[model samples]
Target: MKILDANDKELMTVRKIERDGNTLVIRGKIFGAMPMVARLTPKEARAALKLLDFKTFFFLLTLLFRKG
Candidate 1:
C-alpha cells in the first residue's frame, strides 16, 4: 500500500496488507504518524478501503458539503 503527503509526495509503503476478522490493517509508517493500527469493522473497513483514492473521496466530500 502507498501512503503520501497532502502534496502527493510518497512517504512510505507496505510490502503487504493484512486483515483479521472484521478489521483491515496496514503496516509501515508515514512522515509524522507512528506505526499504528487502525481497526475498522468489515463493512466500515470495506467502505473506507473503497476510498483509497483522494480525488474521488474528496469529490464525494465536496458534494456532501455543498448539499449540507
Candidate 2:
C-alpha cells in the first residue's frame, strides 16, 4: 500500500514484508526511486501495533500468511 503525507504527497510505498529473527524487515522504495529497507525491532513493532485496531491487526495477519 502507498503511504501518503498530509498533503497527499507520496511518501514510500511498501512492497513486501518479512520477519527475520526478532525483527520485521520492510522492503519498499522511497519516492519511487531509491530502494529502502526498514527493520522493526520487537519494541518498535509493538509501538506501531498500538495504532492499529483489532480488526486491522487480524486482517494484516491473514494477509501475511495468505497463499499467493
Please give the lDDT score at residue 11 for candidate 2. 94
Task: Report the C-alpha displacement of residue 11, candidate 2, in angstroms.
Answer: 0.3
In model 1, what is the error at residue 34, expressed in angstroms? 2.4
Q: Estimate the overall C-alpha local distance difference test score of candidate 2.
A: 0.91
Segments in model 1 whose C-alpha atoms lie over 4 Å from true places: 46-68
- Which one wins on TM-score? 2
lDDT (10s digit) by residue, model 2, range 1-68: 88888998889999999999999899999888999999999998789989999999889989977885
Error of 2 at 63 (Å): 14
17-53 in candidate 1: lDDT tens per residue? 6787667676666654556555567788678768679
Which is the leading candidate under lDDT? 2
